[model samples]
Target: MADEVVSRSYCCFVCRNYVAEHDDIVSKSFQAHTGRAYLFSHAVNIVTGPKEDRHLLTGLHTVADVSCSDCGETLGWKYLKAYEPSQKYKEGKVVLEKYKIVKDFC
Candidate 1:
């Protein structure tokens, strides 16, 4: 059987960059957070591929790891993808799956 692809949006818990391309984390086996994990990104968008599909967009865009940079908190990710939803995206809270972190930066 194949994995099911989910659709959702992501907003940086801390930053002006609201929408991003990739938000959902691929492969649940991939480790992302040890303690309380947060979500953050540089851009936002809607994708139809799997969470492993990281290269949905192009250009110098692709925030591999997202950190607080201030307090050094391992946030979520910040990658490049399609534009986020406009006023229409306004809805209830959307839960997104976390991604796997191959490395980290402090």
Candidate 2:
């Protein structure tokens, strides 16, 4: 089987603003608190909220809570630091997924 191409767009459910295209969605995954979500390769016009330290076990690193830039609804997060020299590429990636946004119907 092949991966189906999603030909439509998705938006924040609260704001209905264009955030990501189907091709931008990198993959789908699950979490204990939020269940299923889609990780986008790129996110547009979003406001990343205040940065904070996370991952107590691995030592604290920076992250920001993400939100729709227009309506201020909580979306997901942006990883701000890998906390190490080699893994810095993890920063600036977004986690706005199916649970946080909806398919743009219009």
Candidate 2 stretches with Cα past 4 Å from truth are 1-6, 30-32, 56-61, 84-89
Q: What is the TM-score of each candidate against the true structure?
A: 0.24, 0.73
lDDT for position 59 in model 1: 22
Whole-model lDDT per candidate: 0.33, 0.72
Q: Which digits, one per residue and each the tens of the lDDT, describe model 1 over residues 1-106?
A: 8987764544434442234334433323322334332233222332222222243222222234444333333444443332344412212212222432222211
Candidate 1 Cα outliers beyond 4 Å, as residue runs: 1-7, 19-25, 33-106
**Best-matching candidate per TM-score:** 2
Q: Highest lDDT, which number?
A: 2
Q: What is the lDDT of candidate 1?
A: 0.33
Inter-residue clash pairs, candidate 1: 19-43, 19-44, 20-43, 20-44, 20-45, 21-81, 25-98, 25-99
RMSD of each: 14.4, 4.6
